[model samples]
Target chain A: MFTISLVGPPNSGKTTLFNKLSGQKIKTVNYPGATVDYFSADFDKKYEINAHLIDTPGIISLIPTSIDEIITIEGIYSHPEFGTPDLIITTIDASQLSRHLILVNDLIEANFNVVVIITMNDILARKNFSIDENKLSEELNLPVFKIDLTKDNGIDELIHFIKTEVENNFEKRVINKISEDTFTLVNKYNRISEIEKKVLFPTKTNSKNITKDFNNLHKPDEISLKIDSVLLNGTWGLLIFFLAMSVTFASVFWLASPIMDLIDSAFALSSESILGIWGNNWFTQLLANGLIAGFGSVAVFIPQILILFLILGILEDTGYLARGAMLVDKPLSKIGLNGRSFAPMVSGFACAVPAIMAARTIPNKRERLLTIFILPLLSCSARIPVYLLLIGFLVPTTGSLTAGIILASIYLLSIISSLVAAGIINKLKNKVITEQDHSSFILELPTYKIPRLNNVFFNAYLSTKSYITGAGPIIMIFSVILWALTFFPAGIDNSIYNENDSFEQELIENSYASNIGKFLEPAVSPLGVDWRVGVAIITSFAAREVFVSSMALMFQVNISDEDSIQKSLLKNMQKAKKSDGTKVFTTSSIIGLIVFFIIAMQCVSTLAITKKETGSWRIPILQFFIYTFSAYFLAVISVNLINFFGIA
Target chain B: MKVRNASQLLNGEQSEILGIDYNHPSARRIIEVGFTPGEEIKVIGKSLFDDPIAFSIRGTVIAIRKSEASSIIIR
Candidate 1:
């Protein structure tokens, strides 16, 4: 089957054009690779073309700069591993023709079947510039189609062109203009200029007059400059960034709660009905209790994850992330990273797994690694439930501003500490590593545009789906193993968990995990955690929120399954005692627990993703131990100091 | 004619690039992105702290660090 690749330089609306052509809702964010990975789908749905449509990451040249660009270019050339695209749809931003045309010219010369697509023609026309497409196509000797993929204009022409032009491989028709060796930078420019002379009519309003005078400003639009003047101002930019972040996190709670509750009740209702239908056999119990409960806990996270990606998609689409990057560049540079680190750092708030994956945008290898190292320190959505559950016990009153301060402090602590960690690592890295940092904070602040809803929703769904599918099996395995560990050996009396009673609780205490927890108690007791807490902490490695649910189970609370049963959680935790009968959760001890959680590398999936991304177990293993031990030592020292001060 | 590296040009300064140093590994990239000799470019803006100076090359604005700008000679 014929495979066509959509290729262009960054911010040229490349993906937008692909969406128009193929009717596939790939992300059309102004930044590069909002698709994250290459997306291919059956294009038989469009215009009788029996082919697959592949959307490639934006590239500046046939020569690649970053890792993602390398992927796209390698796909284009059809390395034995990745297939060669049968046809190339070169989407050039019409307003930036002179710079974009060089690649188009190269592809034509390289003996590839080429169709030149001039995108952003409306923006060009709005700026009062014109290009004659017939003249351009005649001169270039390839089919040229002008389109504004956003407005859905000239799409039929683009589609018709694709249908007819597949039969005509332009490489057979158009003579190669220059020998490969002679295609130097000078010759490339000359060729572009000659083409420009034939096709482009000189415009009258080139008079932004930003060039001749030093310190003059030129913006394509006045509104953007005005917005940037405030939004990108050092003081204002920082304030607005925090405000934006507050809204982002706030939306995760405010928006996702209803949907999450619905899903939770749905799972509960389905399991209950199934249990009734299957009757009181071991199979029903296994199917209902083990599989349903286990899968339900992990599946509840899907909504929050989607909302996080959706907010980020909106920010990327609007070009606000670039401004945020510009705002943070100076401070980040001191930490051996630059503005590009902002995107990943912000994403870390949602999930460290994807945030670490997002670190690919940072071009420098060392900085990218540093970004990955510090990313887990960010207070991801996974940590929110853990923090809240602990905080409920740690800080008593619900209405107290102190609770908010503690929450805010945790978030702020994560961000600031990660930055400092990056800086310190950067210093050490320079002395040890042989590589020099080549990538600088060279970001193009893309023009602001309204995010398309279809694209945003598409991206959100795709990421959420990938997360579920990729992690689903492992999570299922986790749930099954944990269930077996807890369920088997029934109790001291072989009674199953019929209701919320101390008898069932005794059974849990004598379970395999509780036995393992007893063994782990010595290690965790130093931080004021009991055996049950130890069990929860161990189970928490499966996922963070499980810590709360595990704690709920150990005490056998009537409302242990309810995520919002915080009052019961607090009461139970307060009454929890060590074997010595002294209260386990002291103010100082809880503080220590909080501190330990702040830095501990707890999530298994994050470690798995880190391993996959870094291409080895070396970094992930080092990260796991170093971070966990560091958190342990920090908790120990802080707890000891507090006890000495008698401040609890 | 007095020639200066793009790094030396002040913000909003205009010059035609004379040549790029052949020794630099990324000179190929700088050139490939329409930064070759005799193409007119303007120093558009400097990011905060001025390490990365933005340049308008071939009518598209792109930012490059002073280290990279040092490789391109312009007049």
Candidate 2:
């Protein structure tokens, strides 16, 4: 099969042309290596070409400084599994012709079957400039096609040309590896300048101001500079960045909640109706509570994931994300992270799974790993319910102000902890192994363009789909395991239930999960929580948000309405007592539980994603054990310290 | 004609590139992005902390750290 790969410099409209050609709904993120989408699609019959098109990450020169560039270079010159691509489609931005042509020169030197597709000709034309296509083609000794990607001008001619080339089945071109030393690069740049002088012409000229006009012509667009003046200003830029982030995050929560609640209720209703019909057999239990529940766990995250990517897509498309990264780069660098780490870390506040996936954009492997390692420590929205419930118990009658302050403090603490952890881990890793790949911050602030809505939606949909397919199965399997742990050792007799003990409570008390909790009572007792809270902790390992529902079940709170689940759970928790007649959910114990939830790596979905992104189980396994134990130890210490202070 | 590292150019100041500090780690990429000798570059903007400065080169805006910009000698 003839494979044609699309290669180009960053912000050269390569992916846009690829999308137009293949009619595929792949997203185009601007940052190199940020997106792992290497889409290969068959040509449409309308094009009359039996060829496969591979869209690689946007890259500059063949001498790769980053992973994305390396991938692009590899895809064209030497793919491991598929050898060299038969034809390389190098997209050059006509607006930045001279610099972009350097890549074309490198490809020509390497003797690849190169087809130059000049994109952004319309942008160039708008600047009162035009490229002489025939002269460019003659100089490059290749078929050069200039097409306006925005308006789809000259596309049919390019398509027909490609079709003819493919049909001819031209002789294989042998790779001639060129020396990429500094001298060669200089020569290539010099050569590109000569070609530019020959083929580029002024569309509208004034002889009187030719020199000034020529100098100013190469400056960046007026609108982008104007917007950047306000947006990249030291104070206004950071302020707008925070405001934009808050809006995105607030939308992720608020916009996704309605859909999430609908999904939650839908799953709950399905389980209840199934129980009503099946009359409570083990099969029904597995179907409704285990299988269905697992599916719901996976489905529940779709809204947040979609909403996050959608906003990110818009931000990325508008070219503001690059500026946002530049704004945060200095602060993040103090902790051994760079600008690229900002997006993923902020996304971690929504959920760690997608946040880890977003870490793919950081070109440096060590920095990427550090970002992923500390991401789960961020106070994600999933822990909000647990925090709220615990905060209520800790200070039952306090006004909303104090509770809000406590919640904010918890968030602040999580952020501080992540930063400190990153600093320490980075130091440790550097000491253990010297890294040669120095992280560099060379980012393009692409000209701002109004985001195309279809493109933004497609990006969101593709990313959400990938997350479901990538981490969905592991979440489902683990959800079933958790279900089985709580569901098994079944048929604890109805007769075993006392007057005060509900059948649900009796069943839970006799389940394997409860047994594990009983076994861990000695370990948890120091933290002032009993076997029941221990069971809640174990059940919530599937997801931190499960703590509230698991606690309701353990306490037999009989929450008939969703609105009052918290109120009833709190009331039951406040009254619940141990065998020694001491009350559970005391102030110190609740604080400990809150701290535990804040720090513990309890979400199986996060673990699954960490495993997927890192392509290894060793890191996830180590992350799980290290985080959970530290959370426990910290909880114990907090509880003891609080008690010693007479806070109880 | 006086020459200084590109990092020394004040914001909104324009200069023609003299050459790159070849020993710097990121020199190759900087040169590849049209920071070669004789190219015109303008310091368009500076970040909040003024470390990673944004420059307009080849009709596109790019941001690089002061450390990397220091390698690009210009006047």
Among all windows of 10 consecutive residues in model 1 chain A, the one with the lowest summed lDDT is A210-219
RMSD for each of the candidates: 4.5, 3.3
Q: What is the lDDT of residue A389 in candidate 1?
A: 77
Cα lDDT for residue A147, candidate 1: 79
For candidate 1, report its TM-score. Answer: 0.88
Best candidate, TM-score: 2
Task: Calculate DockQ per candidate and list them.
Answer: 0.40, 0.82
Runs with alpha carbons beyond 4 Å of true place in candidate 2: A23-36, A78-83, A208-211, A391-406, A429-436, A492-501, A557-567, A608-618, A644-648, B1-3
Model 2 lDDT per residue over A594-637, tens place = 88988899988788778766767877887788789989899999
What residue pairs clash in candidate 1, if any at all?
A: none
Residue pairs whose backbone atoms clash in candidate 2: A34-A361
True contacts kept of each: 0.37, 0.80
**Candidate 2 chain A: minimum summed lDDT over ten consecutive residues — where?**
A25-34
lDDT of 1 by residue, A213-284 (tens): 111212244455456657655466678887998898778766876787687667767766886676444566
